[model samples]
Target: MSDFLVSRRFYAFAVAVLLLGAAWTIQSRVPLSDAAGGQLTSPREGFPAPEFTLEDFQGAPLASSSLRGQVVVINVWTSWCGPCRAEMPALERVYIAEKSRGLVVLGVNSTIQDNETDARGLARELGITFPLLLDRDGAVTSRYRVRALPTTFIVDRRGIIRSVMIGGPLAEAALRSKINALLAEP
Candidate 1:
């Protein structure tokens, strides 16, 4: 074989390997959003999170601005999302673990499907004591562009999104780290 041809083939192979590795790394990190409306299904890592006024489980209007000067964990989730189900226990643990740090973990329920009772019941069964709001018109979900289940946004005391967790099968350590970072900020 000609030396030039061998070198060219070697370079092509190296490029292919690099591209494959990058793709795998990215795919490993991303999860699809199961959104009701056609919107952004993933939580962006560094964007001003979409804000909304949703009612608490008690039906009290909970405004986003109300969380100013407090660390709020905004979780966009659906009862039917498997990853959502898997991550709840860890989230509850984090909420209990950090509530005293001015943390308010609010789970925004998605209504892409026809049923509400089942989702509500599942949340209840999970012993999710935090504020869970219903996005019946899906207006709130559309605003956030949540296309997947269990997308979590961590808002700092300044009401800015410090970080986002997507496709959560998160460990307690992971949740704690993000919460701790937000807590550390002024």
Candidate 2:
């Protein structure tokens, strides 16, 4: 009967261990909330923006590394997103105003679930003359961790990510402010 007692105790211990392990696994999977935790800053901030080589609307190759010396504003967007559509004019204005000041606005069309024609139409309608990159399979979007439509990242001239704006219809004034700040950086 002592052996039986020992076996029962061991089984109980093993079960307890398994339950604790499972609890830990589940807790680790939960996303960290900004309020409950510390301020949740963009993962890319202070890090080099993930390099990617994607084709523009006209099939021209555009690589992130090639724009190293210029402050780059990368906007990940889809034509179907209302906020994305709304921010196009502001983005274009910022592009026009700051392009000569060493700023390049790259509109990355998240085309995995969008039609190429629709993306082109939106750009044309908005008179967006900035370089529009085509993210065909969402690889670039995923790399940037773009969780929402119209997310924008401001990259400094040294290729470090300076700021990230998510859920935009970003205003022209706000864009200019951010761009001016980045342009001022060496």
Candidate 3:
């Protein structure tokens, strides 16, 4: 009877392990491209980006309309996202490097579970100097139909969204190329 019980328990444990493994594999193997609304391919091109006014990390209103007529790189991200934080310093570098050249890097902080105070602290710690727009209710996120973190929208000089780049902290070459494209726009 003892041997039978032990064998039954062992079999159950093995089955559980396999099931968990299968679940993880399914999740990890599913590409981000397969997400709802599919991959965002610059469809926003030649279309004006949705304007929003939200509290910044400093508690000031950061309005999208305020950025009218400037080339802007709008990055939708959150503090909790590992890839978001990892890629920010690079974005900051680009911001400082390009601001004098008339490029604005606006970070839209989306779906923060924590309160504003804690979120502000995290932003400061990240050394992000650009405007951080709060999206506590994810209204702006939804307007943009953002499905993933580290998503980027490039706005042209006329305030039109020229391109959209999604998933991960983009490679330096890829980022520079996109930025250059924005810079070239009239």
Candidate 4:
């Protein structure tokens, strides 16, 4: 009787593991959306990137929808993050080289966790030319589910998220390769 009980327990555990795995697989295949539009927006790859409109560092409104049909690199950062500071120049170089090829690099500063003055100062120090979109109220940051300071989302021309790099001083060479491949895609 004890042996049978032990075998039954083992079987139950195995079934639970299998069920969890199946659930994960299904969730990965189906992107979830939080909005009422059911647009499949998610921070995961193969999902539509979340739409946002924020004031640029210059106080002009910039909408993600306005960048349709262009490859976008959205880098969520804060001025105090060391990795964010380290990757700014690489991001700038990539933006400059690829903007003509339809690349738009948006440095999304989580201003609630940072300040505009420091963000501007860093941009000047690093010669960053990409638009710095400020998330003053933290809405954009929360929408992106940014758990780290330097998360980056690579969205293709169709606005589908192609890659998500979390916690990075992402290498310029790697960044270039990813962008080139996405830009090459139809």
**Which model scores highest in TM-score?**
4
Give the residue spans of candidate 3 off by over 4 A. 1-43, 112-118
lDDT of 4 by residue, 47-119 (tens): 8899999999889999999999999999999989999999999999899888998999999999999999998
Candidate 4 runs further than 4 Å off: 1-38
Cα lDDT over the full model 4:
0.92
* Candidate with the larger lDDT of 1 and 3: 3
Tens digits of lDDT, candidate 3, 1-186: 668658978789889999999999997885667543333333276667888888876678888888876788889887777888878888888888888878898888885543566557777897889888889888888888888887888888867787888877866667778778778666
Q: List the candidates' TM-scores in order.
A: 0.72, 0.76, 0.71, 0.79
lDDT (tens digit, per residue) of candidate 1 on 24-142: 99878644563222433334554445668887666789888777887888888887788888888888988887888888888888865525787778887999888888788888877
CA lDDT, every prediction?
Answer: 0.77, 0.88, 0.79, 0.92
Residue 120 error, candidate 4, Å: 1.0
Which is better, 1 or 3, measured by TM-score? 1
Q: How much is 113 displaced in model 3, in angstroms? A: 4.6
> Where in model 2 is the C-alpha error above 4 Å?
1-43
Worst 10 residues of 4 by lDDT: 30-39
- How many backbone clashes does every candidate have? 6, 0, 0, 0
Which 10-residue window of candidate 3 scores lowest in summed lDDT? 34-43
For every candidate in turn, the CA RMSD to the true structure comes to 9.7, 10.6, 13.3, 6.4
Clashing pairs in 4: none
Clashing pairs in 1: 33-147, 33-148, 34-147, 34-148, 40-145, 41-147
Per-residue error for 102 in candidate 2, Å, reads: 0.2
Q: Which candidate, 2 or 4, would have the higher lDDT against the true structure?
A: 4
